[model samples]
Target: MATESAAPSPFEDQVLAHLRNAEAAYHAEQRERARELDELEATRAALAESQTHARLLTAELDAQRWNAERERQRVECLKQAMREIHGALFHGDVYTLILRACLTISGATRGIYVTCTRPDGPLRVRAHIDIPAIQGAAPPPMVAQLCRDVLAKNDTIVCSEADTAARLSGDEPQGLRFRNCVAAPVVLLANLDGVVLAADKMDGEFDDRDIEALLSVGDQATVAVRNRHLERELQTAYVHTVTMLADAVEAKDPYTHGHCEMASRYARLVASRLGLSEHDQALVCYSALLHDVGKIGVSDGVLNKPGPLLPEEVELMRAHVRVGYDLLNHVPALRDVADVVLRHHEHYDGGGYPDGMRGEDIPMPARIVSVADAYCAMITRRSYKDAYPEAAARAELRRCAGTQFDPVVVDAFLAILDTPEALDGDSDDFAECGLLPGFEAMRAQASPV
Candidate 1:
């Protein structure tokens, strides 16, 4: 009966079913835990890879920043050097200044400036710095020859070693020593003018970096040198043009050869005696030279008249000053000259021609030129009359000083005439007319008026 009852207990059967269900739930929970563990492992691997990628990105960013910074520094240095070069060029001889600047910029052990005599000729040293006393006194012939070759070819040469051994192997001069050298031609357009040589890099042997720096310096030097050369040429040309213009005006009057320039010199001398500033002296000189340029517009008969001018002719002659002023007033380079030309005939005591400018109303340059021109005319032999003696000319200037001539300018002229050299008329003529040679020829081919 107990065995039968054990098979038939509902509550016990329920308990067994509950235990089996619990075991199944436990197995399911264990499976879920294993899946969660696998997911966690995968997440850790992804995080590690992401961190590595972030590190790599940060390293790449740092490298880019470093490169950018270096480039900025290099550009700034080049700009500074260029500015210095520009300043030096304006202040002094361009070649000398550039040579000094290059030495300072590159910090080379030594530097040399060599210019060729001709396009293909040998090179001669113009300037140099930082060498043995003996070497400086006499540069090696091989170095000079090499400079010529480089300039002729318009090529650059960089040598890492400049010792006697290296030089001897190549047939260069002996007893020479240099660790590095760079040579470049001063080329403008396709023509080579000279060469620049730098030796012994202070930091290390010549490399691309060193070469690039030298090249930059060389380029600036070349430009500055060329500009200075051009400026000198322009100054020469300007002087020539001024002389020619004066001559052309003088040629209109048969009795007035070289008179304009002579009068200008006299005017400058007078102004100098007055303790005038250099600028004012120059103005006086320029004005005197151009005082009669308006006569170019006058008729030949009137300009070269051998007799007294008629009242009408005198009026026509007076118009020339205004005409000259008009002709030159619009030109920026000649405005000052035009102003003096207009007022030079004005009287100092309020009675004058054109605008009737009086006293200080007339420019100082005009006043000064008026006194010089009158003095020169008094002492100069004319077709109408012989020249006056020094005493008579001095008396005439003094007589007209307060009325016709500027008082200060007349005083200066008197002082200039007091010198022993002004006693002889011929001496006065020479003093007034001595101009730089070839002035006319130079003027004929000048660029413009």
Candidate 2:
């Protein structure tokens, strides 16, 4: 132990050093290989991440394309709907076209077109899709609130789940548990006219595109409504003009100043008794008032003549119907009334008239007017005749029911005479005239027939 365990010789020491160098070199190489392996593993990980990122980008781009295509299709559908609205005949038809476009763009399950002159009052459900709306009944609380809110804000509003749940008022209509809503308000004549609102989007909550679509459709619908309003105004003006013309003819003849006015009441009463529709009733009444308007075109000599006229003079007198027809034929609202005016002189037996139309050949409105006019003329004092007694007028009306007048019209007129108002013509109740019919009287239909 004491002798330093034998000091190695130089050659042996050199050999040991060489062996130690080799072992050291081997360990260093192993460390280098470990470092290389770590770098390879890191590179593989980076490559995987890049591939994943690429896939994500590709997927996002694809999704965007799909959405773009959907939007394109939606816009096209809306465009087509807009074109269809141009052909809409009624306000109801216009509303329907707007709703269909909304459904197409928003994926809504149901749609409604509501209007109210006041925001606080009950809303009128003019048109609907898939909702059994009772038109005049109370609207669903949710829908009512949506419309009210839209009106108050004067802007479009979108109600998602939470909003619908909180803002919902009383019991909604069955199956009206809306998860989402979109309300587009339409302003007209400087007032809040109404709202076009949709509910229950099927796919998801309403987004920007849905709101935009609704606004576009609302604007289109507003145009249609405004057009209808203008048409109504024009129609009213035309009717007023007709009234003036009737008055002018009456002014020319002292005895006929109130003749046309009285005859109209009789015609309307007869129409009502016969169960004619409001439009038909209005037709008969208007025809009666304007039946003699064409006489304005006749020479004053013929109109003031106290005796029977020659053949040529009579021909001139019969031309009054043609004149009246020409005047009204150009106005679309009065076209139907014109038919009555032109044919009112036709006899029930085909013996009297310029057209020789008989029996059912004459329009029913004209038939009614013929009976009312004859009776009224019989009872009134004319330039050429004396006023007939009430009994005599009644007898005369009965005498010509089948030959000169529509028998059914004569019977209906006599039956409703429980009071003397039919002959008095004193009441100013022009209530049944429907000067601006609710799509019935003075209807301004623009759709292509």
Candidate 3:
């Protein structure tokens, strides 16, 4: 029984060994598959991290690009404003340009330029732009007060919706419904010339960026204002110099004591009555004043001769027109009127001296000055003649209309003389028709008197 049992167990033992080996091989395959899966997962995780980092870098780069673009736009806008401001300065339109530049730079729907005529005077609108709904409306009291504050502090005021509400919510009257407002002073040499205001931003509430842009525009406006101020000063100086020269000429002859002034006033009146352009009016006025300036080249004997002039003295007197033309033609500012001055004594019939330009061939300004000179001379006593009565002067002007004067100018002047305004002694001061368009107030402000 023992020998048979031992012989039969060999097959069973071999089968058991095979089964154990198969189980070990299956475990080894499972371990290899698990390790491969872990390695694949680690690669996937690393790829995901790289993608996230790339996305973050892209977002940062986009943000930087946006910031750079915004800065570029800001700089471009400021540069454009500066260019416009300089153009305005060169052209003498600072008030209008300030409002336009502020509206452009700040993206405002409404803008106002206010200036105080005097240091203590109330603010007056120099220029303004508004939406249709608020057209022709006066500036809100609060807004005006804000402008005053800018003048007072010599600083800028920026008001958001909340800030505007807080400021206007109190006892102050509020007619404005704007969501934003910006105001800056037009300063020059530490003196406040005026305040520039912008309101109702078209895009959004005004922020520090808008404020800073407005400040740059204000700085440009300051330069323009200073330039305008300098130009005004220079113009005043030129006017004074010309007036003194005229005065000196008149002083040399007692008979001509107010002749230049009378001629200028008459010329201005004639120009207005003729509906001449302001530039032409100015030309006529200045030409009449300086018509006799060439007399400075004449000898005292020739200029002050109480009796009729001999042919030689008359030739010398006639030389004054050419002399004045030569003298003023070289001056840049007076060049435009030099021809007018030279031809002021010319006759309408081509019988006059110098160029003998006739009718329309004569410059309109010169013709106007000619009429004025004749009128002034007829009414005022000269070295060779006594003053004529108004009626006699009018008759003389009418008699010489087609010969020594332009008939149209004579008629216009005669009509002006008939007006009640011409009878008023102070009418010259009230007559602003000779002022350039939109420059009457500016000229008045610059008047030294």
Candidate 4:
């Protein structure tokens, strides 16, 4: 047994050596794999960090772009406001011009021009888009009150989404109806007259950007309102001057007094019934009152001819429309009205005057005035024609519908006349119906003779 054991010692030693080598190789491979795993983990960590940094840089860039766009919008809004202020201060009919500008700039679905009755009285909506729901209808009480409050405080009130929701939850009336609003006091120095409130943003609530935009607009509006007030005062004085000039023109012809005055009153009435916008109604009133202004250019002999004129005289009489238009074109205040005056004689059938425009091609304001002028001429006393009774006037208006006058305008005029009170013997009948101011009184003041 001892001899057999001694013979296998070398073999055993060799096997032990091989076993140690295999274990060493296994341990070396394990260490290499561990090193590779550590390297992979480091790579993964670096990759994650790079992605995070990239995401951060991308977010920063997007933020900068958003801020730049917002700044550009603010700058553009400021420029527009400056332009509007310039227009308001320089232009005639600044009130109407400003209203139109506000509508365009604010993106309002509708806007109303309002004036306070007194320093502290409630705001009365004067002009709007001419929707039947708004015309002559009382504004919501809270809106009136809010306007008063803003005027009193001289502070701008911006109703954002949260504020709107909160206000709606309260007893306040108007804010609940409007989804969003921005109101700024229309103050001139220390005098607080009223506030221009823009309501109902089509997108959502009024944000800071919207409030800033409105404030910019308010700055322009303040200037416009002050300018308009001054203009109205000046125009009132000019109206007196024009009245005298018109009276002198009428002095050469007695029958012209009732014709011009009654026609003006009737024109205003028809304008109201036809749903002409407040701006158009004012323009029509001005144009109708001055419709015979062209007659001022006519010689006394032709103007007071008292009977049928010669062909040349009739031709000269027909030139008055253009003459009136030209005269008013020089006066910036009456430029828009002058256009109506020039087209007042245009017929619905395209047979009537300077341009001979037909159907809807004729300006609606002119179409309204045409019916009013004809109706007043038919109803009022004339030198060569007997004044027709109201019934005869109605019949004549119906006869000329869609031919000499727009059928729709004729219908509106007839509807206004259908109320017997509107056609009563009193010359102020239309005024009593609240469609216009006192016709007889204005006629008395404005008549040439």
Candidate 5:
């Protein structure tokens, strides 16, 4: 066997070695290619994961931005509502201001405000805003009831199509229909003052955000209403004080017992007949009541004397107008009426003392007070002169219309007395006041041809 194993070919052995080396190199190349492919796959997978993460972050960022925008808008609406409420408080038109502010904040088409003096009292409609048509129409029963529920609960109610049918199943509005609504209670502590309602959203359906906004407005409205009540109380106290002062002045003279009251009544009537505004009418009445307030500064000797005043006494009596001006001008609240008091004696024909303002130069309130004072004085039984008869007083007023009184004011005063029932009750008092029957005929007789 050793002999037979003779000499294997060296070439064959080398070829075999070469073949083995080539096979090994091919396997190594295949392994390298597989590794490269595996690396490429891993890189692609990592890149895909990064892209997905970036997309997720972008979506989250957009959501955050949207939320921030909504929050900003909500804050802006609240700020605007606060500003409007402050303006309303200052202007003393709380109902209108609150309703308008609520409408702006909620973007509602219509709004209604209601209040009650007592908890069990009937509701009073304070203000309303309806588009296009309808002025101050009463709220629907359902809406009113919903407002009541809000008050009872001391919270806000939001009604959409989802709940409106269930909440107001059997009720319907009279003129308009609503698809969405919101109501809030205006409360201070445990006391429910009123309710505020908003309906028919302009943008979309009302939601919880709207409720929150309205509740905020409701709180401000409650504050405004409270302030209004306080202001009214203060005004009443001030008026009472002023009236007492006027009474004291009138008490100094026995003949002028009812002079201030009569003059104020007559001035108010004339102002109403002249179609003056409510504020102006009040001004005229108050000024007439206080027109003789300066008499306090005059000497009692001249004021209470039963005889005609001497020239010097008359001069002293005339000085009262200036004194009253000085006294009232110091009070900020009464300063506006002070000018009217000072000019009340000024004649339309430029013959009166103090200013001699002629015709329209006189303030309308002063002119009105002057006419009322003159008529009251003429009809009053004074220490120096008997009271003029009704007819005689009317004739005298007509005779001196342009000379001592404003003709326009005279006409208006006469017209006020011309009503059928103007002198209906208490013939004695009417006669004493010189408000005679047949005033229309008297005015006709006094009219220039």
Candidate 6:
């Protein structure tokens, strides 16, 4: 049935619109919340990643610092080792420093430095550390062979326990000595050959570090030894050159042909008897040899005068001391010896040529030369005076002791003269040194000048 048409109510329409708006606002709020949540998650992940990278960077920095410290320590250790090796003065000192440094660096339980002057000779152990004492003991068979091998190849070797065992024969016992070793050759000179070996590390097997250490030590030792060898050669050459110059001075006069040699021997013996050190004895001996060197500057007329010298002539003869001192002082190496040379003619009681330094003022070496020089003069024959008998010479020494020479030195020389074959042995020594052709006849002559 159709009824009259009904119009829509305003309240219903307004309510429906409000509900639609509310639903739309709820959906928009949900979408905005989701976007905020997504942004939060991304920020958290970025924070986590940054923190992880920071941790890794921190670790790397720590590693770098640790490595730097280790390298610094290594360099410092090497410097100290160089000091020890280079400071050494003699061959034995160098050998000891090398072995000790090796043992310390490698932490070896046993170590040895073996060398030989001749290629074919057996290895001689120059230095060792932590070795059980065995009388007349030689190196173990394997070690000897290893040293020879190292010497031949000039190689640096790092051997493990297995390698050590393999080097031995199959029949040999297991777990033998020298289970691990670091060995290197010390090769520098043609005449010298050596091997430095460190064995049985306390903590671990031999490694590259140990081999490097051994090689470094061997290199240091080689350099030090080479320096000492060169120094010795230079010193020998200098001695020969000076001795020849002194010899030239003597060659000018036949009467004084061997005067310097005789004086040198006497001075050495007297210096030793006086308890002087070997170094001091050498200085005195050399000074005595060159005491008359300046006599070459004197004219032949005055030098070979058959009678006593006039006042002026005596002054000229005495000037030889100053001339010798000046000649020696010009050489830098002889400056110290020149000091002694200048004072050799000084008398104990102050009556002498040159500066006339008296008593204890004279250098001990020069004082020693004085006694030796006077003694030689008393026993030697000259154109002006005959050689005094030994008894007369001794008496003259005693009479002139306090006045012209140091009494203590004179007493020491007198004691040496009292040895059983002392005076008799002089003849053989004189002949050996190419002294005047007839020393026996010279000793048989009359009074001293």
Best by lDDT: 2
lDDT pick, better of 1 and 2? 2
Q: What Cα-based lDDT does every candidate model obtain?
A: 0.68, 0.78, 0.74, 0.67, 0.73, 0.72
lDDT digits (tens) for residues 1-449 of candidate 2? 47557789999999999999999999999999999999999999999999999999999999899899989999788888887765453334666777788888888888888887766766888778886676655567767777888877878898777787777454665555567778887665566667877888888788888888887776666666676677667766867777788878987777787788788888888888888977788788788888888788888888878889999999999999999888877776677777888999999999878799999988899998888788778888887889999789888889998999888988898886655666565645344466533334333443435
Q: What's the CA error at residue 366 for candidate 6, in Å?
A: 0.7
Model 4, stretches more than 4 Å misplaced?
1-225, 418-449
Cα RMSD for candidates in order: 12.3, 6.7, 7.8, 10.7, 10.8, 12.5
Between candidates 3 and 5, name the one with more favorable TM-score.
Answer: 3
lDDT of 6 by residue, 310-361 (tens): 9999999998887888887775545556777788889999997698679998
Runs in model 2 lying further than 4 Å from the true structure: 9-22, 89-92, 116-126, 131-141, 187-192, 220-222, 242-289, 295-319, 326-336, 347-350, 357-449
For candidate 5, write residues 337-446 as lDDT tens digits: 78898999898899997977888889999988988888888889987788987778888888889988988998888777756434444322222222111222333454
**Candidate 5, which segments miss by more than 4 Å at Cα?**
1-84, 89-92, 116-124, 130-144, 160-177, 187-192, 219-226, 269-279, 298-301, 355-361, 419-449
Better of 2 and 3 by TM-score: 3
lDDT at position 269, candidate 6: 79
Residue-wise lDDT of candidate 1 within 217-254, one digit each (tens)?
A: 66666566665566556545655656666677878886
TM-score, prediction 4: 0.49
**Candidate 3 lDDT tens digits, 303-374:** 889899999999999998998888777665666667888888789999998877788988888888888778
Best by TM-score: 3
lDDT of 5: 0.73
Candidates 3 and 6 compared by TM-score, better number:
3
TM-score of each: 0.59, 0.66, 0.69, 0.49, 0.67, 0.64
